[model samples]
Target: MKNIYELVTMFHDVHPFVPSLSQFAECVVAYIGVFVIKSVFKHLVCLECLESLYSYLTDIRNYSLIARKSNDGLLFPAKDVI
Candidate 1:
């Protein structure tokens, strides 16, 4: 969570946006809720649970990169048709 806070701080600092710690906490809590709920049902082992989270984060990073690169501002290109 400290890492997340630092990353959020750095992102807002670089982008010159207002930083809302409450909103950040809310988002983190929501993700934690989802993780807990999924884990409860899935019975994932520790390593598998971390891998699932890592994969989801990686997908989010990739999506952001794709959105940043696209002129039309769509997350997925029209040609990709996802």
Candidate 2:
């Protein structure tokens, strides 16, 4: 019983520091986890955006190919449809 009391007292003496350190560790871990998730999501979204952009550009190129040159000296590609 005496040993248990001393152990409890010792733990009580360090109570403030224990919780503070635990909270700090948790925040650090959570920040890192959030950063990792954000990076992965950004990468995934960028890939999809790139594919859409390529498709749009290809469509414009096809339009330019079919458009006839006007009587004026300079005939520019048709305006972007989308």
Candidate 3:
């Protein structure tokens, strides 16, 4: 929390408008996470398609895991259209 505050203060001049302090921390953390993800994706030309495929496969695996937890059909759906 303190680190977020320090970062926001340190980088305040970068943005034209300031968000309210209540939303500042959440916004900054989300912005940073997105920035990092974008930076990672930038290195690979076909990353977006691969990432989507990976995410869909993970969802299917998760569904199978859930189904195996019990005999009952808990029917977790796959992300078919990513």
How do all the candidates rank in terms of lDDT, highest first? Answer: 3, 1, 2
Q: In candidate 2, which residue ranges exceed 4 Å CA deviation?
A: 1-21, 45-82
Cα lDDT of model 2 by residue, 1-82, tens digit: 4698898988888847434445445434433433444444556666654343222222333333222232332222212212
Candidate 3, residue 60: CA error in Å?
24
Judge candidate 1 at residue 76 and give its lDDT.
Answer: 29
Instruction: TM-score each candidate.
Output: 0.26, 0.26, 0.26
- Give stretches of model 3 more than 4 Å off: 1-22, 44-82
lDDT of 1 by residue, 1-82 (tens): 4798898888777855766556446444444444454454366567654444422232343244443444742222121111
- Score residue 60 of candidate 3 by CA lDDT: 38
- Whole-model Cα lDDT per candidate? 0.43, 0.39, 0.44
